[model samples]
Target: MRISLSTLGCPDWDLDTICTTAADNGFDGVDFRGYREEIDVTQHPQFTDRLVETMARLADAGLTVSGLSTSIRICFADKREENLAEARRYIPLAHELGVDTIRVFGVGDAEEHSLEELARVGGETVRDILALDGAADLRWLVETHDNWTSSADCRLLLDELPDDNTGILWDVGHTTRLGGESPAETLDAIGDRIEYVHVKDAVYAPDDENAKDDGWVFVLPGEGELPIDDALRELDDRGYDGWVVHEHEKRWQPYVADPEVAYPAFAEWYRTVLE
Candidate 1:
């Protein structure tokens, strides 16, 4: 399996530095977060041009643009239309960048939708996204997060959609947290539809308040308490060849330290554990 690092770890770093860091660390690709505040997606009249430039820069650095990671909420009660309209913008951009998949979020209660309503809304939103996807030559991926963080729930919703242009971003830590499902079972639920994986550790102190369901506090690949070995074994057993991006999401935490210092150590630890 190819391993990559999420650009989110270095949100304060420029794109060039992000790519250079990933390349220098012997990572195969860089999972670019184009929707971060640092990037001005609306500056260019032509989003495709921006995409080309972005991909070209990565190519120059000898790195592949693993995927376009975006923080998109698919289900909103009052703003659903506006959200979808803006989201359709990423499809063509992904296509132009020669990147096949774009990351998106599942429906959540933050949108004022009830749990049941969120599922219904989630299904409908996926249908709409897939409809728009037919012309983009790109795939739409919903991460294991928010309301659909449960693997069973996500699997059910994904079953409702056409797999031709839709799949799952199997975020192990997120799903494990929200689903209350075992990692093996979660992997079995998603099965072949997992387009990518976000590798992070969920750890907690015994006395910490957030110590529930595998604990809390997202950490680097190995520092936390996640059963990452078992998860990777399951992925291997399933023949999953997609990118497994190290998602050091809480890199800003003083305990976690800078990604530059944490990531290489994390990667080395990951390699050692996997081996």
Candidate 2:
């Protein structure tokens, strides 16, 4: 039940400020966004060095690393090869940083590919990345995003991969938005394959015709209309202890002004509700 914040919410800030703010706010860890403007491919070659420094900085600030969110698509056709090659470059870096997982997104949309094809492509991509073994370090984590956000869909993809080192990184908000599935059902579908969890809240209006595209919006854990309490209760009942990354995605959803300001509020909410 350790709580963390993804730097995705604060893509405009530097790593130093991010670590400092996270530690100051009583957060346990920071999920670094590896492909933002402030944090991008230029440092890809020096990843080992950069990650070592990042680790030290967080340690000095009394913070841990929840994970790394690499903005690389693993399931897309045109970008899959280049993305895998790029991911191969970060495996050693992640290991050196003592990061256990790297977050990746699946490709295709509900409109583009059949569920069967998406599952096959997602599984194949995961198998390939898991085989990299760069420095025999790091595990690949497929996130509940885009096409694979459904609990049943992700379960299908997970069935195709080796469950030992590869698994699901469940994003609650995204799952609810895209899949329109209940938290209990989603958890039941993924079962033990959930290696990580992205915690956020959203409001859904199923009655609206634009509901699928525009109903959801980011908010603090307990602030939004989402059933976070029920979700957390289910997670607790199941003995789930994965990282709860407070992923208020300000990059795409800018309702929250700044992560520096928002993370502390969310941390307080987590402490009050989850503690």
Candidate 3:
């Protein structure tokens, strides 16, 4: 399996810093969630007019562009145009960077609409995007997040989609801690469709008011309570050779361990797993 660093881990780092740091830390690739202060990297210059320069920088460091995480909400029918517009902008960028996988959000709130309704709308919206020219060349993985953390609930959306080209970004932390799924159980439901993965770990701090999923706080990989090794084992046994990205999420939680600390920590943990 290939290991990569999500730029979510280092929100403040520029392209050069990202490439050098990732190569130094033993990462195979860098997944662009954003660059520097810009969260929507499609609009960023590194991905636009200067894309060739960016690609050369990554290649010089023996890195690939693993994935791109976008804020496009696939399940929200109300923002259909916004979602399609986002797709139009990034589809070409994806092709130029040789990044075949991208992350989108299928995060539908149960309060806003029924699962069936969300799935129906999401299916239509995603199909529309996929039908666009050059879109079929790339895979769009809807992140396992928000109200759609549970793989079973996620199936309602996944089933509506076509094939492997559209799937889930199985965030182990959310599915296990928030969705209450064992790794085996999650694979049982959507293993075939898991084109990419986000590797995060957290401790169950049920009393900490600021913690997510009722106190499951994000921590450096292998340091917190989540089943880092078991999850990797399950993926290996199932023949998942896709990118397993260390999503440190410093963009959202600025107080967490810095990428310099967290990225190598994840790499060291993966080495132990291989042993």
TM-score of 2: 0.87
lDDT of 2 by residue, 157-208 (tens): 7777667767889887777766787789888888678888887776665564
Best by lDDT: 3
| Candidate 3 clashing pairs, residues 3+ apart or interchain | none
Per-prediction RMSD in angstroms?
A: 3.3, 3.1, 1.3
lDDT, residue 240, model 3: 88
How much lDDT does each candidate structure score?
0.71, 0.73, 0.88
Q: How far out, in Å, is residue 35 in model 2?
A: 7.0
User: Can you give the TM-score per candidate against the true fold?
Assistant: 0.84, 0.87, 0.96
Candidate 1 per-residue C-alpha lDDT over 1-275 given as tens digits, one digit per residue, 9 for 90 to 100: 88888766776666677777877777888876643454424334324446566677788888876887765676555557765776676666666666787787776674564556665666677667666754346777888886778877787668655678778998888766656777788877776788898887767665665454544765656677777777888888778888888877643443555778867876786578768
Candidate 3 lDDT at 71 equals: 91
Candidate with better TM-score, 2 vs 3: 3
Q: Write the per-residue lDDT of candidate 3 for residues 1-275, one digit (tens) a residue.
A: 99999998898888899999889989999899889888999888888888889999999999999998899988788899999999998899889888889789986667989998998888998899998889999998888988689988888888888784788889998898878899999999988788888998888887876487577788878888988789999999888898999988898987688888999899999989878
| Cα error of candidate 2 at position 255, Å | 3.4
Sort order, lDDT high to low: 3, 2, 1
